[model samples]
Target: MELRDDQPMQHEIGNRTYIVADVDPLDVDGVRTVEVGSALWLLGFLALLPFYGELEANGRVWWLWACLAGFGLGLFGLEYCRRRRKARAERDGLDHG
Candidate 1:
């Protein structure tokens, strides 16, 4: 069976038919997401700072370090996503001033 370009996907498996929506994906560049994530991670690390001694006593100090790592990695991801979004916009002629 043929489906129209704008039609949702329909798959029949076993005794059930699944219909997937044919909606367009969001055009987010992910820079904001990364920034928010990085901020959250930094917040988590700061919030855990006061309990550092207890964390070290319990051998869970890695949790704080993990948050720092997440923030660092998110910084890298933010830059990459920003560059990717710029390139995509330029390619699609959506970078108009």
Candidate 2:
């Protein structure tokens, strides 16, 4: 089958057909999930700050640092996904145009 630029690319396996597009629904969901997770991590870190001394004394200071790291990684992943999606859109536009 000829893939048409004007239509979404599709695949058929067995009896199921799947449509592939530049902007995937799952990608949007993933981005949203990452954003929420990142916010939660930051908030958790902040909320636990008052007990930092106790946590450190108990040798569990890593929790705060881990949360901070997770927040940073999440933000990075979100940006990366967004940029990748944008680039894919641009490429698709150029290809179809």
Best by lDDT: 1
User: How does residue 83 of candidate 2 score in lDDT?
Assistant: 74
Model 1: per-residue Cα lDDT over 17-85, one tens digit each: 999876777888788899999999999999999999999999999999999999999999988998999
Positional deviation of residue 4's Cα in model 1 after best superposition, in angstroms: 9.9
Residue pairs in candidate 1 whose N, alpha carbon or C atoms collide under 3 angstroms: none
How many residue pairs clash in each candidate at the backbone level? 0, 0
Tens digits of per-residue lDDT, candidate 2, 1-97, equal 8755587478899999988767633434266778898999999899889999999999999999999999999999899877776777687684311
TM-score of 2: 0.63
**Global Cα RMSD, each model:** 3.7, 7.4
Model 1 clashes, total count: 0
Native-to-model Cα distance after best TM-score fit, residue 3 in candidate 1, in Å: 13
Runs of candidate 2 with Cα error greater than 4 angstroms are: 1-29, 94-97
TM-score of each: 0.77, 0.63
lDDT (CA) per prediction: 0.90, 0.82
**Model 2: per-residue Cα lDDT at residue 18:** 89
Which sections of candidate 1 miss by over 4 Å?
Answer: 1-8
